[model samples]
Target: MLKEKGLLGNIGVQVVIAMCVGTLVGAMMGHSASMFAPLGSIFIHLIKMLVIPLVAVAIISGAAGLGSSHSAGKVGFATLGFFGFTSAVAVALALFMGEVFQPGMGVDLTGVEGLFSNVYADKGDLPSFWATVLGMIPTNVFQSLNEANILQILVFCLFFGIALSKLEKDRRDPLINGVNAIVDAMVWMINVVMKIAPLGVFGLMADAVGTFGFSALMVVFKLFLVYVGAILIYGFVFYPLMIKVFSKTSPVKFLSVMKKPQAVALSTASSMATLPVTMEACEEELGVKNSTASFVLPLGATINMSGNAIYYGLVAIFFAQMFNIDLGMSAYLAIIVTSTLGAVGQAGVPGPSFLVVAVLLSAGIPIEGLPLLFALDRIFDMIRTALNITGDAACAVIINDMVSKDPSHAAEEKVQNA
Candidate 1:
């Protein structure tokens, strides 16, 4: 269908061109590029307006669909398992690459002393396990919705959906149908907002590059390059391999269809913002079932942070090597566990990455140098956000196959009857 729209009409191509042009404009205009910031801000706000309600309704519809079939618990477990396992693997891979490449060795921190500060020291103190658990249970769900508290919203919606599924069909079907309609309307709204994506992308990039020029990046250029390489290895090599081995879907076709969502992810740098596009690609293009896409994708976007995990792991190792701290087995273990879990705990929104402070502090690495990377986080965030959504789609495709094989699911029942 996108092919029928011609090259100029392809959002992916338009986004790529916008990114290039924006970079050029920013490089030339410097701080004057701030003039375009409003364009990007407006686009992001429009997308955010729909994300909360869309995620809330879609999760309800999906959970109700699966819960009625008695497969909700199984699918939930499978989804979490995939997200947790892949995230751990991503951190491990980043650690391995960091150790092998030694991106922080032979580095010069000569003039970056002013960038160092201890403001983020308190961030490393993560909340207690029980505190984290309690935080997910919103006392007033309406307040949670108003605050756009995604994790709490997810918890409430899932519970509501399960309860709804227990009702008789006479009562349940109408609410489910209504929720589905809301999800459809949300998608339509997302489609309308996406029309100006190229202009929004251009503004976002131009402001980012102009505000944080590549000057600081030169100091960490090696780390940047290695980080990109690791991302490519995971995105191009690992995800495709998993899809080819486990799912019936063609990995080549999966990659091809994913370009649209990936482009949006690249520009927005917020998986929550990119979610509607990701959902459309999974259901409409990649043939992921609507029920699976609705549940797994929202959950994945919330908890699945393989890309962020990699960043944490690598950054920990980078700082360690830079400081010449000889990390023992205990330190590596701390980095792995903290990076994986911290990444999962992170919110899927765009902003400074404070979670990295936790990873660094967990392993006794310094947090003072974090500002060096903070300035460049936007560039890094854009790239990894793309990979993050790709992981979401990969899991959806695999889980779709898994659900289709379970005879208790409605889709599988239909196939069996056919």
Candidate 2:
């Protein structure tokens, strides 16, 4: 859109500049830098206003489009399979890196021991399998919408979208068109909002840095370093490989176009808040089908949290090493399973990942040192959130390619040609 405006016109470039300046300003001003926070808050609220409705309408439109085809069920399964597989791989990689680096060993906890707390101990109990399933099925759809309950919203929209697709074309087309119109309107609004993203990003970065300086990081610097390396490996190495093998996209181009969404993800640290940018990046820049992107991206944002899986696994191992607890083969398996599942169960919003608590508890790791990490969770959350959105886009691109190449699609095109 800003092609005529040169390099600085690009949203991604602007955000990066804003972020760097914000960081310097924050470091200089310290806590007082929070004065710019309203810019960030206003921008986040604007994005939040659009997210629930956009997700609902977009998914319904996507599902209906796919449901009209023979590949709906295939698309659904493939997306879920991709999320599960990537998440499992992420956890395993984190575990491997943790064991190799041993970020938790030789930690002088003398002064920092006071930061440990049992406040989060009670939050570690994971819901039963059946309960988690049941919770996804909302008893009140409107209430779910009001609360912005993403999983429940996804459940209803997918079901409703598929049902809409079953109607006669004369009936379905009008509703689908109406839904598409809403999506287009939302997209336009998002574009308008994005013009101010640089200012908003500046506010967010300044506030985060000013409030939580680099001092807290010194305590667990090794753990933080390892965490970032895992994210980079996953984002730059693993996802690019997946795209190269499974889709037509070049890894370079995909990464290039992704800078905008990744910047927003870093600043917001909430996949849900960054949903609009991710969707636009996939559909416009990556050439993913709206039918594929709308369905897959939102679902990915809600549940496909391979980034969090890595964090949970690494943190579990870190604490295990710190406390001198020997993790057996069973414990490793538990960490893998728990971390993967826990990552999926987490909400996409920015917050302290108490799910890490569950992962630690599952592997018999200590949770006492968790508060130390929590203090620096913002930085950790920002890095991982960027990776999370990248995973979502990769799955969308790969799945779109799969659907296009399906035999059923080929036959259907031939039938139309005839």
Candidate 3:
């Protein structure tokens, strides 16, 4: 029993061991970290490759399905509410956790100034709030499509879905049916890609271990614990309470159905990349209507990053602490506001959270405290990504419960079993 538990339930333990071994060899031989860089790059690329098509098809199909079932207003409100509530909760929880723990309290920040200064050099000017809002409107539809701008894609989808909802019943069926077929095919392709995901995860993990070793692991350990603890509180405590109050569902059961998809998100570390699996789990396993699942999950993948938002707060406090700087109440408030907006502003851009951290620091705070945190971003990113995806799935379940025709019957079979 002990052996099986250690072997099957503790991949993180094995990863630590690998990191120790790799670091010892590299240190002794004076080897370059570049030797292990390729694996991480390849894993990131594989995820990026799947992102564009997966998002486009998922959003389009979801939007179209929403149009077929309900008024555009209902669909729009539900999506907005889910994103808004989750984002608010995420930011609040992260701030609370950061204040209580102070993970960066004792870290030394000497000699790290150049690392952040160089990293943030070309990040350019931080856009104003109104400008960021304006940028959400795509100047050119095809250009936005080619650029894979998620907010732009979402804007287009909102209009497209509303138009589809307005179509006569007789005219809509054939179009919806055709799009559904294409979506089905695309989902299948995503599954085929997923079979390779474990390999990608393994390579990424191995390379991270090989390059950074135990010292990096310690930094990651601190970030990981803080981030994971915040997620558990949110996922298990906060979200469940919201479920009870607003949706009247079993949060325990909701989380159970979410486990498989959460695992997929952690392994992939990309919410958009995990959408195909999330959609399947919500529709088939959790029994959310396709219309609701399609609309909510894709939008959640793009914008609903509860975990990432939390990480942003925690890391911002973390860097402040490392620099022996006091982030007064005002600063914490600023972080809460900025991180929430930053999460939205940087959606669909690779590692934008880290870049946003640099922006926040440069805007004031301590610009030099970033590299102390960078060594562990990849590790916390995996956890944040998983939590983000879980939040998305949980919201889908709650929304489905609200809109189901036979709510109690659907709840009994799905929630109880899940």
Note each model's CA RMSD in angstroms: 2.5, 2.7, 5.7
Model 1 agreement with the true structure over 177-257: per-residue lDDT tens digits: 999888777777766777787888888888877766667667678888889999999999999999999999998999988
lDDT of 3 by residue, 75-150 (tens): 5687677777677668778768877887877654344334445455455355787887888888897898788788
Please rank every candidate by TM-score, starting with the best: 1, 2, 3
Alpha-carbon local distance difference test for all models = 0.84, 0.86, 0.66
* Leading candidate by TM-score: 1
Query: Which scores greater on TM-score, model 2 or model 3?
Result: 2
Indicate the worst ten consecutive residues by lDDT in candidate 1: 1-10
Which candidate, 1 or 2, has the higher TM-score? 1
Backbone clash tally (model 3) = 0
lDDT of 2 by residue, 1-418 (tens): 2222243236557766887888788889999999988887888788788778878887898889888789888999999999999999999999999999999999877666677788888988888899999999999999999998988999999999999999998999999999989987886776666668788878877886677665645668899999999999999999999999999999999999888788778766778767777888898889998888888988898899999999999999888988999999999999998988898888787767888988999988878888888546766887899999999999999999998899998797688689
Predicted structure 1, TM vs. truth: 0.92
Candidate 1 global CA lDDT score: 0.84
**Regions of candidate 3 where Cα sits further than 4 Å from its true position:** 1-33, 68-71, 109-118, 121-126, 209-213, 348-352, 405-418
Q: Please report the candidate that would top lDDT against the real structure.
A: 2
In terms of lDDT, model 2 sits at: 0.86
